[model samples]
Target: MKFLKIGDRNLLYPIIQGGMGVGISLSSLAAHVAGNGGMGIISTAQIGFREDDFYKNPIVANLRAIKTELQKARDLAAKVFENSKLTAKFLDILKNYTPFIGFNIMVATNKYADYVIEAVKAGADIIISGAGLPIELPELVEKGMAVSGNEKRTCIAPIVSSRKSAKVILKMWDRKYKTTADAVVIEGPLAGGHLGFSYDELNELGADTMTSRNYKKDKYDAEIKEIIEEVRIYEEKFGKKIPVFVAGGIYTKEDIAHVMDLGADGVQMGTRFVTTYECDAPDDYKQTYIDAKEEDIVITKSPVGMPGRAIRNDFMDRLKSGPIPIRHCHNCLALSVCDRKTIPYCITDALCSAANSDESHALLFCGSNAYRADKLEHVEDIMLELTEDMN
Candidate 1:
């Protein structure tokens, strides 16, 4: 595959492991992917769920975990280079390589700006924000840079699903910050977790069915083209190339080639990575994806006020009957969007349950091709398979 250039770093393969939440993609997964030459990302959503004081002081715990996780990922990547049995080619790749470690912080989270600042201060190479339009991301990033006093400017990227969202974010950043995005991740309808598209739009796009593959190629390709064209306008104004990566429903080497041929600089995949041995999720969680069927994948409502794709389970079935009683608020999402009194259920609890391997009542988020996984694999092997056919 072609190298994915972001600022000064050239990722060996134009592939990014999409960040999964609540305990899924952490130090282990991120480190392995980065070591293998892909941009590895850790999800900062309730990252400290295992901490003793998480429920009592969620913000403090998460902020502390941010530093810990990033350090752990770097350390893990370093250990790979220390191995005595490394191949000559692997040794060559490590000779001058610095693992590209990043964090995915949702814009809808409570204290969104705080999380951004914490991630930057903790020395994240890049921060990818989504779950809402990151309108003030540039401002937050600048603030973080100032607070950290770090020599290297932390790169920022916003996740957008359509040309309109892309245009709005880029124009706002240009007008306000006199800058454009370092990169852009275009997430489509078939993505896991909280999707940007409306429920109606996703339904019309046929995001959940086997036919969605054809839909992505024939119909979604137009949307991808439009967004790339919009980004090109800002690229010219800023006099730099802003790489665009496409996420959702990207499973194989062919998927990577198709999106690249359609103008995407790279591909971001989440579901396929969950089955990797190095992924932070429990074995049961990974098995959920392996055991899932085409019919088991469904779209459900999220407390973040967006539609999410997940595997159908007892939890989802119960939600269909009525609003589940929320025992306590984790205060995870912004109060403006997720009011404790009005929301259906506590998203933090559900996702945390999934992370802890309580699959019966957990929110099992997965991409459209989640059912395609049949066995656990290694990150290095998966990375090779995805880029073997590319130049």
Candidate 2:
């Protein structure tokens, strides 16, 4: 294994735990990953859903929880490395790294700028945004950094699907904002939750139209390779090394080695982490993945206006009748265009229910490889299996 360096921080392992939202990956899972030598990501998606006022004042609740979760992660990191001599060189470097904590803020969220600023102000080490093209991300992050007054600029990475999106974002950032991405995550269609590809593209690749299945990594590698090539162009232009990490369908040790050979600096696994003991989701939710059969995982058009992968269940079955009315708005997204008449269901409600383990009436989002998990395990054990030397 090698180091994945972003900004002033160098992760001991080239692994980034994918930020599963709706309270799935929070302080607990993030702290453990960072403590064990990888970048720990906290999903800022409805993070405050548990707060007393979350239903009434989601923005306030989310902002407050951001501070709490970040502090918790920092505290955990401090306790883990407190004068501990795991190794002479390792301990010395760990003292300086900022716990490798990051925040995943979706680009499509309502008050997107507010989320970015708040996360940065709360001392997030990295800010990753996806779900839509984050064209203004550079400017947003720059403003946040200025407000933060932190000497070191927080690292910013965008999740992109192809070389085209990467080129557009890097060019816009460099020419318009005089900034570039610190890194880029290439998330393929096989990823859990929401996907980045068009419905047509997914179908043409032999995946089911409504639920993506039978998707293969080899089909996406060429695209990833081209994206790496495009990223290198900006790397030379900005005179910085922008590491590329591939996400989706990454499950085994061989999977990690495959991406590394294809020029990825690391691999980010979401579904692989969902079954971990430290994952923030309820036990029943974890068991949902374990119990899923290959045929049960399907893709659906999410209320958020994107194609998402999830385990098929009764709640999803209800959608077949027609668009479900939105009873309450959790204010999950910043946009005001959403309407109950047109959308499928209340995304906030469904996700929150799933997070709270009410799976029968909730959307059970999963990666294409989710059904592969057959048992519960510790994050430590999972990480060990993925990184163990096959030689």
Candidate 3:
């Protein structure tokens, strides 16, 4: 595989471990992925759920956890290099290794700007934002860099689902901030958590059925191609290479090859990593994916005012009857998208429930191919499996 270039660094593998929230891809997973030469991202979505004051003062807890997690991920990644049995190629790469630990800060989060600044000050190598178009991401990132007193700017990327979104983000960043994305991630309809596409769009693209949406037949492939071409324009204008990575249903080596052949520079994978031993989610949460079948995965409306793909479970089934009563709001999401009184359920509560292993009443977000996970494996094994042929 070609190296994923970000600023001056070269990631040995053009693979990114897609960030999962509510305590799903944290220090352990992020560290291991970076340790293995890919960009490892920690999701900032309610990251402080484990902190004692999470429920009482979530904002402060989450801010604190951002620094804590970044430090922990860096330390763990260092330990991997010091202790783990690594391949000779990896060792060669390690000679000048600078482990990439990124933060996935959603634009829809309540303290979005604070999260970005805090992550930068805490020494995050990169910040990847989505959940909404990060219109002012360049401004926030610049502020963070200035506040951190670091000459080395933190790389920033925006996740987009279509060519239009890509154009909008790139054009706005260039016009407003005199900057463009360091990289871009194209998340397709089949991704997990809150998706960028609406339910109707997904159905129209034949993404609702597993049998109809194979990689060869995926309609989203055309969209991905369009996005790549759109990014190419900005790349030319900025006189820099803004690498584009594709996500959603990217599972095996073949899946990686398919996107790369479509002109993608790399791939972002979330579901495939969920079943890894290094993943931060509870074993029971991982088990849900292992035990899932194609039919068990369904699309549902999210409290964040978006459609999400998740495993159908008791929690999902209960939502069919009526909106679940909101006990309390954590103020995690933006007020514009989620109102406590009207939202169907507390997204933070449901996600935390899943994190704590209460899957029956939890929101278990997953990608389309989550059902294919038959067993838990190591991050090293999965990374090797995906990049073995590339080397």
Best prediction by lDDT: 3
* Clash totals, every prediction: 0, 5, 0
Ranking of candidates on TM-score, top first: 3, 1, 2
TM-score of 1: 0.95
Q: Write the per-residue lDDT of candidate 1 for residues 302-353, one digit (tens) a residue.
A: 8777888888899988888888888777778888888787788889989999
TM-scores of the candidates in the order shown: 0.95, 0.94, 0.96
Q: Model 3 off-target regions past 4 Å?
A: 83-87, 90-93, 209-218
Task: State in Å the error of residue 315, model 3.
Answer: 0.9
Candidate 3 lDDT score at position 146:
91
- In angstroms, give how far residue 10 of model 1 lies from its true place: 2.1
Model 2 Cα lDDT, one tens digit per residue, 1-391: 2466787667777789899889999998898777766678999999999999998899999988988998998888666445323212466455565558889999888888898888888888898888888888877777887998877777899999988999888888889888889989999878889889878878766554433455555777888999999999988988888989999878888888999899998888888888988888899999999999888998888876778888999999989998777888777775653555577788988998899978777999998888889998977677667666621
lDDT of 3 by residue, 1-391 (tens): 3566787667778899999998999999999998877889999999999999988999999999999999999999877655544445457656767778889999999989999999988988889999888998888878988998977788989999989999999999999889899999999877888888876777787775442243334578888999999999988998988889999888999989999999999999999999989999999999999999988888788987788888989998999899988877788988887877788888988999999988777999999899999999998889778877765
TM-score of 2: 0.94
Tell me the RMSD of model 1 versus the true structure: 2.0
Candidate 1, superposed: residue stretches over 4 Å from native:
81-94, 208-216
Q: What C-alpha lDDT, on a 0 to 100 scale, does residue 272 get in candidate 2? A: 87
By descending lDDT, how would the candidates be arranged? 3, 1, 2
Please list the C-alpha lDDT of all candidates, in the order they appear: 0.86, 0.82, 0.87
